[model samples]
Target: MDENGFWAMIEAAWGVAGGKAKPRQRLSEGKLSEGRAYALQEVLEEEVVPALLERLDALSADELLEFDRILERKLYDIDRADIQERTDGSDDGFLYCRGFIVGMGRAYYEAVRANPDRAITDAECEQMCYLSWHLYHDKFGEMTPSGISRETCSNPAGWPPDSKPDAAPDAAG
Candidate 1:
């Protein structure tokens, strides 16, 4: 698909997976504003993926492999879980799905940052986001706000805690 088509698909998939709305209705009802869509595309292409890659670049090959393994584990969990099995059903599932999408976006960013010459394209990011959303939604029914919060908290250093040690420890001690 062309770039615009690809992004549209990403937005639609996110809407559906996150329980935002069906694409047709969202388009007709003016829910999926063009500006918002464009902004999301920009963030994915220019900012998010680049940032992620930068973070990954600082890691050694073994670290990258470990991060990949973590992502794989999360993906597996998404595939096996059934959203409808939960009491909250699809609504809660969607929230969780959105969280996963955000996480995947961060991952793409890391990957692109790690290898600037091999930066991920907008199309690739969109496709990955779509897939991640569906995987989480299908497994979790409706996603919870708590899930989103937890995802946000996954990187505590991003926010930084209150205190730190003032001096270096003696090696001999």
Candidate 2:
């Protein structure tokens, strides 16, 4: 799927998992506690995940890979120290936090991307990161790595080469 289609699925999932009052409203009002985060995750897992799986099930193998790549890019693009610090998690936890941001849909994702301070510290959506992998394994009996790492600080462009202590200096100097 294309970027728009990818985001549309996310948006739809968010709508389903939102329940009556809407999760974003709670997010905006700063009501996201650890308990609330877990509650939201539960709803997403129960309702949205099966829906997402059904949608992914219909895609051709190529489209599924494309969707995974787009998800990797989205997660990669948000892999900044500023965002991670705000979210406050372990390496894997940070990855899930980023997935939570993407699962919130395009508007919230863009908001957090533009301003890391907008991140919610308590929320996570780990399942969103591995949907394509799960489907690919089920369908083909094999899973190819996406070549991009979804872990925090893994994107060179987002993290910057100079920011890494082990980075090599310019050879021409």
Candidate 3:
């Protein structure tokens, strides 16, 4: 799917699951306390994911692949040490946390992408990491692999070459 189409579905899912209040607002306004964030995470998994999957279910195989690519790229792009540290997860957990950010739709994703401090610690949307996989399997009874890896520290630009995920960025004057 194209970017607009992809984000429209994400927005729809968030609206359905989280009401009219945008996640970016909640995060920026400090409305999502730990308890509220956890509650939102549960709603995302139980409600938003299914809503998104239902929308994705209508796409052709090629569209599904495109969706997978976009989602992978979004997750990969945010796999930065600065962002991951704020989110308080590592490895698969960090990957899922990125998924949660993406699931909040384009505005929220951009906000968090531009500011690592916007990340919500302990809030995760794990099901989002497997969205395309589940849909592809349910539709065609097989797995569909994409060109990118959504794992933490997978993006070269986000991490120093040959450095561990938690390593600090280079110092320069």
Candidate 4:
């Protein structure tokens, strides 16, 4: 739930990715190692490899919204100048971070659906659905009820099915 937790997860994922044991460090105790800062340059296309699995298991399933909030900040509040400086304007970091946040929401929905014992509030589910659609549309260049249906259904078996259409919708509505 803090930057140390975030950096630790980042370090662990990279360590695993490179075929080494995850570097488990107490990031809360001090600054992140400058060593891993170098790897950020090598991240494919500069995309921040989101530590999704790390976050999922680190916190209880019911606290997914907290995860969502973290992603929200990372995606929305990311300093453009900082990312540009870090990755030389590749845009990979920006795209990846945004997608990663949305991805976490999607993962949470699927994970919770598969195991309902750690259920989120209905409002949280709806927020996840909205966030999913918003991000999907942002990346995919189109938004439709069908797109939302794929993700935000009571059950995955036959979701977003022929539900009643809203009276009207506008581009910004």
Which candidate has the top score in TM-score? 3
- Write the residue-wise lDDT of candidate 1 on 132-172 in tens digits: 23344454444333232222113233222321112312223
True-structure Cα RMSD, model 1: 17.3
Candidate 2 segments exceeding 4 Å error: 18-22, 25-38, 141-146, 160-173
Lowest lDDT 10-mer window, candidate 1? 79-88
User: How are the candidates ranked when ordered by TM-score, highest leading?
Assistant: 3, 2, 4, 1
Global lDDT of each model? 0.34, 0.73, 0.77, 0.32
lDDT of 2 by residue, 1-173 (tens): 89999987766665666542456556544455657656766676677777777788888988888888899889989987678778855777788888888876676688788878778885788888888878877897775676777776677666554442233222234
82-157 in candidate 3: lDDT tens per residue? Answer: 8887885457778888988887677668888888877788688888987986787778776555656887776768
- Root-mean-square deviation of each candidate, in angstroms? 17.3, 4.6, 4.5, 16.1
What's model 2's TM-score? 0.78
Q: Residue 52 deviation, candidate 4, in Å? A: 3.9
Q: Rank by lDDT, highest first.
A: 3, 2, 1, 4
lDDT of 4 by residue, 1-173 (tens): 55445445444554545522221121111233434423322341122233335344445432433444444444443222322232222233323433322332333223323342222111111222234234444445453232112211122232123431232122133
Error of 2 at 13 (Å): 2.8
- Residue 142 displacement (Å), model 2: 3.8
Q: Provide the global lDDT of candidate 3 against the true structure.
A: 0.77
- RMSD, candidate 2, Å: 4.6
Error of 1 at 50 (Å): 1.3
Those runs of model 4 whose alpha carbons end farther than 4 Å from true positions after fitting are 19-51, 79-94, 97-173
